[model samples]
Target: MSIRQPVSVKFILTEQTKQQILTEQRRQIEQLTAEMDQIEQQGKLALEQAMTQGGSAAQEVRQQIEQERNQRMEQREQLIQQIQQIQQIQQLELGTELQNMTVETMVDVNVGDDWGMVLMGSEIIIKDGIVHEIRRGGQPV
Candidate 1:
């Protein structure tokens, strides 16, 4: 990616941070999917009610329901785009192991090591005086 204006940063790479970001993005995607499903159910219920009523009022309600469903579909599409963006960021993060030294910032960040980047919305935790344990994450092959 390209930065609008270049600024130097130092970044630290960690497995936990990557997983956290992926989890959050997945949560948002799930939430959006649920909302879309709800919208479909609501539209169906409205149409069903209008059908049972059967008249000019029913016609008007049907038209309104169709309009509302269209709007909800648009919202779902936007949510899908958001999920794609998150996936793109995830891939970018995985491609490079950011450790230290200087490089122009690709995006906004709250980096905590000599810091090339932590990207926006990421945090680095500091434990108060204890044994620091660093090891590989995930299951054994």
Candidate 2:
């Protein structure tokens, strides 16, 4: 997997791609919700027409309306799930806290090396996302 660190190691997260996708999804849900009202109206009209026709026709229309409502509910649930997933991904993407250094803005990158060292007041040895060892000034790594 790619870590998505900054190329200059002096940047922060400012990408709007994920956010933009989330916005689009929200817009879609809104549109679907608006359309759901129309679906309900159509179902009502179909049922009323069937009632005038009597017997099996009315029953069939009822079943069809129920099925259509179920389908719309399922679609709404799926949209809700997708929105939740996108929110989770966005949170995970923003979760990294770089306490030692601050980068104003950055991009996603893959660090090929397994181990890295940063010399502050101490020699900080890091592997993966964990700080393994911190040797103070004048101490060997």
Q: How much lDDT does each candidate structure score?
A: 0.52, 0.59
Question: In model 2, which range of ten residues has the least summed lDDT?
Answer: 5-14
**In candidate 1, which residue pairs clash?**
9-115, 9-116, 10-114, 10-115, 10-116, 11-115, 11-116
Enumerate residue pairs that collide in model 2: 4-108, 4-109, 5-109, 11-103, 11-105, 12-105, 12-106
Please give the clash total of every predicted structure, in order: 7, 7
**Tens-digit lDDT string for candidate 1 (1-141):** 333433222233345545665676667667767766786788778768877878776788767767766776676677678667656656664324343233343443343532333232122222222212322111111
Candidate 1 wrong stretches, greater than 4 Å:
1-14, 93-141
Model 2 per-residue lDDT tens digits across residues 1-141: 333332112112224545665888889888778777887899889889999999799899888878877887788889899899777667754434223352332222346532342222333443333555544332544
| Native-to-model Cα distance after best TM-score fit, residue 10 in candidate 1, in Å | 12
What RMSD does each model have against the real structure?
11.9, 12.9
Identify the runs in model 2 with alpha carbons over 4 angstroms from their true place: 1-14, 94-141
